[model samples]
Target: MSLRQRPLQASNSTSRTTSEPPGQPTNPTQPNCHPSTPPRKGIRLNRILGRIVPIILLIYIAFAYDLVVVRYAHRHLYLQRRRTLLPIVWLLPAHGLFLWSLRAYLRVFFAHSPQYTNKSSGLISWLRTNFGAAFPDPDEAQQLEQQRLNTLATSLSNTEVKIELCQADGQPLRCWRDNCRARLKAFRMRHCGDCGTCRVGFDHHCAWFDNDVTAPATLRAFVAFLASIPPLYVIAFGPLFPSAWHTLKQIKDFTASDAVIRSKWYNKWYSWIGGPAFRWIVGYALRASRWPKPSKDRWPHESPRTPVLVALGAVFVFVATALAASSLTQLRRAMLTVDLERAKAYGKLRLQMEKLEKLTNGSDVEKLTAIRQKMETLSPTQYFKVSTKDKNSGEEKESIVALSPEEGLLSRGSAWANIGRFLGLKQASSSDGPAWLLSEPALRKILQAAALLPRENSN
Candidate 1:
């Protein structure tokens, strides 16, 4: 009996020990046992914030502009001043700027091309057609693709954009199979995951525009849209303070008038709905109201608009001016917002590469190759010429460097030249076109003859 009891006790103890290890979870089968709750909550919070912030900003801007400019400023301007035939001239360039800005904003916010539409005829059928379309005749497909690319290049060149292939030591370097196919299909094109569409020279997916802002065609419109806001605000509210002051005086005088209290319409309405409750409600509203009290002091040129409205208008003007200045700087540098973002990423990668190189004494070919591969992935189109020195021999060795376009690896020409190209004064050209096609320099001279009018002139 003792031997049997001892064996049973030993077996039970061994089973208990095997089932539960030290400092381990008692119930591993439970789904909530793992500590993954905080990360998921954080992700959800971020997603919510990302959407809410943009909506809040847009709503605030709309409300501010409506109150300060349209409702208050315009009304005061018309009330105080007599109407004139050339009232359009009052907002120097703002009315015109507003129109152009609105046009460009519409272009960016809405579809500039039919390809941006999501209304598919048949999703399954379209997928089936495209899936097997490449199978029938590979050579024929390639040739047709080449022609399409050439046509696209010609169109861009006519618009005054300078697109070129990656050159190594003054010679055009060939790309890998996938990149070569991409080049043939659409030069420097990228598919946007957020937009779920392929855009040429894909810059970035803009949540504000709810679209992808890309190169060649839409870039000018985007810049114009940014450039238009400041002037539009100036034209709309340049005389806001004066008009608001006049409106305040008018309101004060009207409210204080014996005629307003004793008017037949007011007397009839007061009699129809007279009570202590109504009087109390009216008293509360008067106290709660933000409207300014009547002032005894008068200025030479007092505006009829509200002081609050004038302050808001001024704030909007300052904000627009700041945004305009930054946008103009980006234009002069020929740098897209996306480009600036990419530059930051490229700089980070360079720092990492330098650290890795130092760790391996700059001789770890495999690590160097991995870093280079990442750099290439970020900016597939731009190229750089880099030099590194040998630690032992101090000899300099040159290699073709691949950096993201955000890093500005390519030439932006002069500020005026870039502006010219952006304004369509210069033509878009690409070296990715067929070898038989005319070179960029030669085409530039010829295409400049048919330059479009500058943006300001058209407006």
Candidate 2:
């Protein structure tokens, strides 16, 4: 039998029915099948409350005990007379450093940069459509999809292919190819029909600026990424360290006089400053106070100051290294523009384009147009252009130009460069060339340097 002439199955086999035994009545109000409910706003609210309430309560209790119990006991026993404000002094800077490190860590983990935003939203949506629908078990599917996407993205860096093209005049076109090196180092790539070249590290297509994000904007983005560390560290570590140390010590031995004194200080400090004080101030104060004074009597007990200073120094060094590496990479990318321009001056750029045209099949015009339209909306300038264009126009003419190697290279670097400028960093220039500029690896490295990745299974 022909495929179209295959037998049809009974609809009743798949369909639900309300038939029942004698005396039973079907409930008309009930849904045909229980519809899956979207997670409610209250569920998110409860999650937030659950996480926040305990931290808040613990902080509150610490402060209360220090004020009502520790202070009263110290005053009653005249132990407050020998106390020097020196502990507070050390506590302040120490606390500040701890908080700074914490802030840096959290920022690395939770802070969203445009680069991160693009990757996450794209990945999440892709996973949702691909895996979410294909698998029967939604939760299991999501996990599998996430793992698959990450693996695919990592693996794609090594794949290389040569694209062949032909000229419009029926001349045999040459092949255009990029090696594994380029693919591995690329932040992203964009195909621009008008320019007839593939740009690398393309940040975003900006129609409003009439330019893509290049040079300065990319630098700015890096700066912004770096800047976020200080604040995030403060938020994560400022209260957490001091509160944690005091709490831990309290657990081990409640009778230590030093613990009692530190406890008193924490209570007053929390009340006076917890509500609105800047994170830096709180951190500084915490660092200055000596809870358990340096004791040479025990082999395992190292000087508290040494560990605190070492940690702070390590963090600072990592941040510095990341900043330097990112800056150098951007410089190298800028230099590529000059190289490309020189290649174009020698007619190589045109040759490469001709080659690309020869090797590939006719343009996937519909796919290209759709991709361009999607990209245009991402930028302000493109948004305006889209708004101005008539919706009914099925075909919009695109200007095609042969770019000099420099122009081609610049086009590739422009996206990240623009992001840097947006974040207030110096623009990439033609004189400097580095491999690290605006690449995803560089971004990931910066995050790692900032200690953004979880050290343990926080969840």
Candidate 3:
């Protein structure tokens, strides 16, 4: 879940304490456990930063809007005799894109509808979706989640896969990392430390949005917002293209003249005052602003701040492109943001396994030894509890199985199928048939590639 840009902790603690802030109410069933440990300062800091990041981002966006629309289009272009109507032409689609992007931005930040399906959070969630469909409806999602799990259990019923995510006594898994034992009902649920809840399709907690991007609600909007950037830039800058080109020429010309750097008033005034870095920055600003540049009657299009619009627009374009690409790549692979981080750790093990496969067994003793040493250090990222049957007694026993190098935890096969699920594009199936999979981050084909597990688990 990008607007940019955990290992399985199967905790079995049944402590009744809810993870609330210092001043908030604690769980009445459990005794207070605060005195045993010092309060973590990091949590308080994360709270402060999360609240302000979106505010700062909005401020930045607002500044760009003013610079582009008010300053350049209205003020400068209107004054230009032949171009009076050009601002309207440029701003019509520009404003449309801007409003659409703004809506998507807010949706990305706060539209966690699927997570709010319960009576407590129901009304607001309905309002967020206009009391209509965004993606997966709450009732449908719950049904789908149950169906997916049932099918999964059925498939692994008689298999030899050693899974490890069983709660010791059918109790809920405690997320010690977040200091919460909240029930995670959503598909592929992960507890977001910042949000203080397990979000449905929980991706990562984005610091910039100050929110979590759980799919079927915020994922589509996040992608839409990023995708709008290039078109928005093109529309906003269409009329100002000539002026921008001229400004680039001024900067280029300014750089070639050594005399301008040492003698221009913009450069000379603060040259000694700011040590060197600050003065260098001021010089860069001058290149875009004042060097060989002022007309007899300078318009807002020729203002020093014009470069700010260009630079910001260029940067957002690049950022949106990169973040969008990264997100699509992950979605196509059937993993969310948190799953991607887990993959990075396991990816190292896969590389070694591939190398070992190429060489004959025991052919190079040194290479084999080095591979073993590396594998020992890089333990499997996640463990799942697969039920093993005792052949004679006909009883099932659960064993914690580590992921083999070639296997992944989230994939449900084909890219199209994965993306269809990620976007929540598929409608719910009949309750009798297999419902749409929200995500299979539980266990990919964990047993299909079981040959390496025996050796790696030994390591």
| Candidate 2: RMSD to truth | 24.9
Over 4 Å off in model 2, which ranges? 1-84, 90-105, 111-323, 328-398, 408-459
RMSD of each: 20.7, 24.9, 10.8
- lDDT tens digits, residues 279-362, model 1? 534532343253344343543234333454455556656765675566557656665555566666757878999998889888
Scored by CA lDDT, what does every candidate get?
0.43, 0.33, 0.56
TM-score, cand. 2: 0.25
Instruction: Mark the 10 consecutive residues where model 2 has the least summed lDDT.
Output: 380-389
Question: Highest lDDT: which candidate?
Answer: 3
- What clash count does candidate 3 reach? 7
Candidate 2: lDDT of 146? 36
Q: Single out the weakest 10-residue window by summed lDDT for candidate 3.
A: 1-10
Higher-scoring candidate on lDDT, 1 or 3: 3
**How do all models score by TM-score?**
0.48, 0.25, 0.61
